[model samples]
Target: MPAYSDAPLPVGLDALVGMGMNRVKLAIAVALAEHGGCLSTPELIAALGEGVAGTTIARNLNELEDHGYVTGDVPRDERRRRRTHWTLNHANLHADLRALIQATTPSGEPPTVTG
Candidate 1:
């Protein structure tokens, strides 16, 4: 098992927000979450739609990986060329989303019913 930072999830969420992710990143995150944390680049692109380029996908994946949101490894065949496989870190994923949503709402206020 991989080691995870136990610091408040909000920190990580804030980090992601600071990184300036757009719809592409969100889609990648959702796809990784839905798959229970593992998918190929080609698979992700196919799942997301045709307009996404391989280089763009690679870049986003690298960003997510750098942020500790995903993990990947390269496997080589007889020619020694490498292929990478990515796995989402759900622990981080859900925690980050929860924290982000919580941060967006007004603080010190409870929801009131208006029936």
Candidate 2:
């Protein structure tokens, strides 16, 4: 996947804030949706940029998980780093969420891999 850009989210973060949505959570969802696979906390932090504190992202990820918007897993092997890998939960309101994201984006499409 392409590196997450420092570019503001498609609708602009401020716009999302005005919409009364949790920006970090939505951003996390967007990142996971774009990745099309699991993303570790570190990867998410990097993707989201240095401006957002890791603690803040971690907290938001837990909230997203609790809300069933995302799921997280930890590697079982002792050799591997015990990082939680997160993925968007397609079983939930995925389409609606995607539509919400797409509506804010200029392309009117869910985030693409090429981005």
lDDT by candidate, in order shown: 0.69, 0.67
Looking at candidate 2, the ten consecutive residues that score lowest on lDDT are: 11-20
- RMSD of candidate 1 to the truth, in angstroms, is 8.4
Task: Tell me the lDDT of model 1 at 29.
Answer: 79
lDDT of 1 by residue, 78-112 (tens): 21344577788767766666666666668886533
lDDT of 2 by residue, 1-115 (tens): 8795455554423323322357888788788878885688889898899889988987787666666667778533431456788887754644444545666567654564221
Give the residue spans of candidate 2 off by over 4 A: 1-20, 75-81, 95-115
What's the TM-score of each model vs. the native?
0.67, 0.57
Please report the candidate that would top lDDT against the real structure: 1
Give me the displacement of residue 16 in model 2, in angstroms: 15
Native-referenced Cα lDDT, model 2: 0.67
lDDT for model 1, please. Answer: 0.69
Query: Candidate 1 clashing pairs?
Result: 37-88
Candidate 2 residue pairs in clash (backbone atoms < 3 Å): none
